[model samples]
Target: MAMRFSENADRMDVRYVAGLARIALSDAEAARLQGQLDDILAFVGELKKLDVSGVEVTDVATEAQNAWRADVPIAGLEREATLANAPLARHGQFVVPKVIE
Candidate 1:
């Protein structure tokens, strides 16, 4: 858990996070956000008063980690055998549309 960022997460942090999330908060929004963040920090502080001494941590998911076989190098399919299933190929690679364009 991060301590209160009020001392460090200034307008710069809010702005940087907003930029990464593609948000465009106005002056009022940023000011409101600062207050909201402060309240959230205070609430988190309140939770620290709990006594969870014997609590056992748990995995929240039903899925289990897949255990693999021994580390011996297994033979893989040949390049032509694998590429045979691709819808289209160029230079022995899958030819998807250029995403950045």
Candidate 2:
């Protein structure tokens, strides 16, 4: 079933959305955002009215495939080379400050 964006606009609360997103919005900001949200819903509603029944469904817009090269195992830098530029290294590993108590 197709979802109706316009019908859900009335139920969309800007303050509620902001709270869920952990954002603090003033009364004026909420009002502004609410209007913008309504406009977006109206636009989506217009899009829902388009005739797309004849269009073929595709996962990607382009025909390109296997975009990435084969991942082959190769020798990495030696331990000494890898830790040469580190601020602190001991026992063939980086020594960073304690992050947790």
Candidate 3:
């Protein structure tokens, strides 16, 4: 099945991946990556069917949570330091380069 699918990787069904990712992979690159992806998927398919009769399921193998100090107000950067790299500023807001037409 893997070999057959890889050999016929030219079908447009595979190209939809590039469109969804906003990429323009060339024919060679797409074909190459398609084969790799198919192989990975096939391996995962095999893994999914494994029988783990005694294994435990957890959200994560090593569960952890965030630890941090309490949030509190403190002194902040001085105005000179805050505007050091800004091209323009009005009031206290740093102006940014125009990104819209």
Arrange candidates by TM-score, highest first: which order?
2, 3, 1
Q: Over the stretch 2-64, how does candidate 1's per-residue lDDT look in tens digits?
A: 133344443234555576676888989978886786687767767668887888768766566
RMSD of each: 8.7, 8.6, 8.6
Candidate number that wins on TM-score, 2 or 3:
2
Scored by Cα lDDT, where does model 2 land? 0.78
The 10-residue segment of model 1 with minimum total lDDT is: 1-10
Compare the candidates by TM-score and give the number of the best one: 2
Descending-lDDT candidate ranking = 2, 3, 1
Alpha-carbon TM-score of each model against the true structure: 0.41, 0.49, 0.45
Error of 2 at 46 (Å): 1.1
Give one digit per residue, the lDDT tens place, for model 3 in 1-101. 01233433433345676776668889998888878876767666676678878788767656567657788989999998998888898788898777589
Clashes found in each candidate (C-alpha, N, C closer than 3 A) = 0, 0, 0
